[model samples]
Target: MQTLSELGLAVAQRRRALGMTQIDVAKRAGVASDTLSRFELGKATDFGARKLLAVLAVLGMEMQYSLEGHAGSLESLAREHGLRR
Candidate 1:
């Protein structure tokens, strides 16, 4: 998840899950197939922000943030019901 390839693969998987081709998404995002391919293939270390956002928009995805220690990283949310580690 920290690498380009991992992110690209995830995006590719989700796009495929939606039954869309690379061309379809690229066109929708107003980008070239090659650009999307690099993203899907995990070759691009820095996928352009605007273009990446566009692709995410096409796929109904977005970037969000969460605070660590405030909420559980995995199994539970810390401080919920006074839970403590």
Candidate 2:
């Protein structure tokens, strides 16, 4: 995602898809329930990497990275470069 709010929303979606509660995820991730609530609600401004990674781990998820202009998938890149029809 392009921003922290987007990331938080994604986490919330995943949690819901997995039928997980905020308290359960927070306990498993070693964070406060209010913290997770704020995060999922896009109200957290300083949720750190450790807590984020912990939550992702609890949800069987991980973060990915790409340089600014290198975020496209292979299919999109091929299309943009005229290598695909």
Which candidate ranks first by lDDT, i.e. highest? 2
The lDDT of each candidate is 0.83, 0.94
lDDT of 1 at 5: 78
- TM-score per prediction, in order, is 0.74, 0.87
Instruction: Report the lDDT of model 1 for residue 17.
Output: 98
What TM-score does candidate 2 get on C-alpha atoms? 0.87
What TM-score would candidate 1 get against the native? 0.74
* Worst ten in a row by lDDT for model 2: 64-73
Winning model by TM-score: 2
